[model samples]
Target chain A: MIEFFNVLLVIFLILSALAVERTKDLLSAVIIFGAYSFMMAVVWLLLRSPDVALTEAAIGAGVTTLLFVGLVSRTRRWE
Target chain B: MNDIIVKTVTRIMVPFIQMYGIFVILNGHISPGGGFAGGALIGVSLILYTLVFGVGAAEKKFSHRLGDLSESGGILIYLVIGSVGIVSGGYFLTNLDAGFLKGEAGALLSGGMIPLLMVAIGIKVTSTIITLFHAMIEEDPS
Candidate 1:
């Protein structure tokens, strides 16, 4: 069960990473990046590093997304 | 941004998020989450509030002056605490050697100077994130 979940998370992480890069809209990219961070956090947790997972979830998904959204709002949304 | 549901949810959620952050910071030595993660959680709570209420109101709640003071004070506290170790004829940040009380293992107050250091780091990270967000958003893009 854990292995299946880990595999699913890794697949989602890769998909989100690609989606963030390929997305033209900056807002969508930021959101996708946040998802990627969240998946990465889960992966970290599954790998037995809860500390890294917490930092990744908070700083990566939370703060970085907010900063990117703020930047996107200030600048152009589309590439 | 002006949605009532969002604002209401933010109001309800911010306190819980901040409380969890404090919990993480206090239990850092015994737990997985530490100062950086906890502080980021707290910072993100404020950032969420700012997003819902707007920068003007957020600034009113957490003024730049207060942010600046805390930002400097956090590091100063860390430095002062570290200096305690040196002043006591030990290496910098020396916890047990510096004569800090160590309680039982797995307890909240067991880590001597570590918890204090975590608090300092938590304060510094929280203020830095808030300051950075405010600076980024408030900058006039001329």
Candidate 2:
């Protein structure tokens, strides 16, 4: 059961991550990236490394995304 | 449908989701989770709202600048606490000999500053991610 869940989680993580990087809409990409990072954090938790998960959540979903968004907000949209 | 119906309901849901995030962060140590999982989940929730609604709404409720500061603050808090252990004759993050509070393992007040630190991190992450999502949305929707 645990193994099954892990596999499913991994799939979700991969899908979300792809959506983040591949999507053209910046907003959608940011949202997807946040979701992707959240899934990664969960995987880290499942692997019994809460610390890694915590940092990822903070840095990935938290800070990096913020920087990206802030930058985008200021820049004029190309399209 | 940019109408009053959705806005009214979303206003209510926001607080609930935010609180739940705190719950997850606080309980991270005991359960199969920690600050990151809970924090990111909260961050994503906020992002969903921002994406569906707008950046102005999210900014009104949650400050972007504050979120940025909080992210750095969380890390500083964690490091400060860990450093205390070293200053008190213990290695970094050494709780045993560290001159700091240590309560029961399972209790809310337990785990010394670990739980507090986790909570701080959660707040930092959630706010940061939400701010990021808002920035993206606020970008020219071309």
Candidate 3:
């Protein structure tokens, strides 16, 4: 059960990363990046390190996404 | 940004999120969470507020001067806690030897300087995140 979820998460992470890179809309890419980080956080939690999971979820998914969104808003969107 | 749902939810959730962050920070010695996680959670709550509201309102809640003072104050608190050991003729960061009140092992106040250090780290991390967010979002001079 856990292994299945792990595999699913890893696959989702790869898909999210690819989507982020291939997306032309910067906002979508940023959101995809956030999804990737969230998947990573889940992976960390499954690995039994809640500390790293918490930091990853908060900083990676939260702060980094916000910063990226702000930057995207400041700059061009279709790039 | 003007969504009423987001604003209302954020307003309702920020206090609970902050309380949980403090709980994590305080329970660092006895639990899985420590300063970094707790502080980041707190920072996230504030950022959520910023996202729902505006940067101006967020700044009003946590001003630049307050952030700066907290950034320095956290490290200063850490330094002072460490220097206590030296003042007591022990090595830097000496816990028990520094005469700190070490309660029972599983208690909240048991770890002595550890909780204090976690608090300092929490403050520093929270301030750093807020400061970075503000810096990134600020208007360009050019």
Candidate 4:
């Protein structure tokens, strides 16, 4: 069951990564990238590195998304 | 941004998020989460406030001068603590050898200077994030 969950997370991670890159709307891309970061954090937890998972979730998923959104608002939204 | 629900939720949530961040920072030596993660959490709470409230209000709460002071003071505290090790005729940040109380293993007060260092890091990271966010959002001078 854990393996299945991990696999699902990985699949979602891949999809989010691709979606972030392909999305023309920069704000949407940033949101998708946040999801990618969140999935990656869970993957880190599954790999038994809770420390890395915490950092990834806080910095990658949270701060980076906010910073990107700020950038998007400051500049153009569409790529 | 003008939604009352969002404002109310953020107002209620920020304190708890900050408390959790402090918990993580204080327990960094014994726990999975440390300074950076905890600081980021605190920073996020502040950023959420800034997003919900106007920048003007957030700045009133956490002024730029305060952020600058904390950012520099955090590193200064770290440096002062590290210098204690050197002053005691040991390497920089020499922890146990620097005569800090080790306390009991798995205890909150254990690990000597490590907890202090984590606090310093937390302060630095939190202020840096806030400063960076404010800087990025500030109006263009040109």
Candidate 5:
């Protein structure tokens, strides 16, 4: 069961990564990146590193994505 | 992502997740986790809230100065805890001879200063990471 969860999580991570790269809308891309952080956090939990996982969830999904989205909203959508 | 659904979900989830983060930070001793993990989780909750609500609203929530102060404060806490061992005993971070606290194996406060240090690290990591994120988002004057 855990293994299946791991696999599914990995798939979600990959999908999230692709979403971040491929999305036309910057906000959507940042959202996807947040998804990627969440997936990574799950992976960390599975690996028995809740500390790293927590950091991943916080920094990745929380701060980094928020910052990017803020920048996007403030500036032009694309660089 | 700024849809009503996202906001609603965030409203429902942020409190729970943020609380869990603090729980994880405090319970790091017996478990496989520590301060850094839990602090990050807390950071995420705030971050999620900010992302959904917009930066202006987020800025109103907390100032950059507070974050920076917290970062330094965390480090100072860790240093103070660690230094107690040296002040009381021969070596730095020497838990047993440091005369800080009883060394019960499984109790919450039994880890002497380990838990405290972990909490400090958690504060340091979360604040620093958040500040860095803010820097990235804030307009570069150059």
Candidate 6:
């Protein structure tokens, strides 16, 4: 069951990564990237490493997303 | 946000979030979360406030000077705690045997300098994040 969940997480992660790369709008891409980071954090947590998961969730999903959104707000929207 | 519901909810939720962050930071010795996670939690809370209420209000609450002071002060506090060991004729950061309190294991007040170090680290990371966000969001003068 755990391995099944890991496989599912990996598939979803790949989809999100592709979505982030293929999205036209920078804002949407940033949002998808946040989701990707969050999914990665959850995967890390499931791997029994709370420390790495916490860091990924905080820095990757939280701070990096915020920074990207800020940049998007300041710049042009289209790719 | 201009939406009243979002604004109201944020006002009600920020305090609880900050409290929980402080809890995680203080109890790091006995819990899963340490300084980095707790500090990021608090930092993200402040960031949420900025996102919802605008940067002016957030900066008013946590001014640049205050953030800088806390960032440096955290390190200073850590250094001071470490130096106590040297003053007592031991190596730096020598906890539990450096004339500091050593309560029973698993106690909140136990771990002597460990909790103190965690607090210092928490302060440092929180301020660093807030400062970095502020810098990124601000309009460049160039």
TM-score of each: 0.97, 0.62, 0.94, 0.97, 0.73, 0.94
Model 6, residue A37: C-alpha shift (Å): 1.8
- Model 2 per-residue lDDT tens digits across residues B29-142: 676456776787678667656655777776776776777788788888888888988888878988757755677868777777778778777767676667666656666644
State the iRMSD of every prediction, in order shown.
0.6, 4.5, 1.8, 1.4, 3.4, 1.7
Tens digit of per-residue lDDT, candidate 1, span A1-79? 9989988898898888889889999999999999899889889988999999999999999999999999999999999
Separate clash counts for every candidate:
0, 1, 0, 0, 2, 0
Q: How much does each candidate deviate from the true structure in C-alpha RMSD?
A: 1.0, 5.7, 1.5, 1.2, 3.8, 1.5
DockQ per model, Cα: 0.92, 0.21, 0.65, 0.78, 0.40, 0.65
- Model 3 off-target regions past 4 Å? none
Q: Give candidate 5's error at residue A54 in angstroms.
A: 3.6
Those runs of model 1 whose alpha carbons end farther than 4 Å from true positions after fitting are: none
Give a tens-digit lDDT track for model 4, residues B24-137.
999999999988889999999999888889799999999989999999999999999999999999999999998999999999999999999999999999999999999998
Write model 6 residue lDDT over B1-142, tens digit each, in one string: 6889989999999999899889989999987888999999899889889888998999899999999899999999999999999999999998877898999899999988899999999999999999988888787744
TM-score of chain A of each: 0.94, 0.87, 0.96, 0.95, 0.91, 0.96
Deviation in Å, model 3, residue B42 alpha carbon: 1.2
What fraction of correct interface contacts does each candidate retain?
A: 0.93, 0.24, 0.66, 0.83, 0.55, 0.62
lDDT tens per residue, model 1, B1-142: 9899999999999999999999999999999998899999999999999989999999998999999999999999999999999999999999998999999999888988999999999999999999999999999997
Instruction: Summing lDDT over every window of 10 consecutive residues in candidate 4 chain B, give the lowest-scoring window.
Output: B133-142
Error of 2 at A34 (Å): 12
- Model 1 DockQ, alpha carbons vs. true complex: 0.92
Task: Give per-residue CA lDDT, model 2, range A1-79, as digits (tens).
Answer: 9999999999998888777667878866877888888888889889998778876776677656756665656664332
Candidate 1 Cα RMSD (Å): 1.0
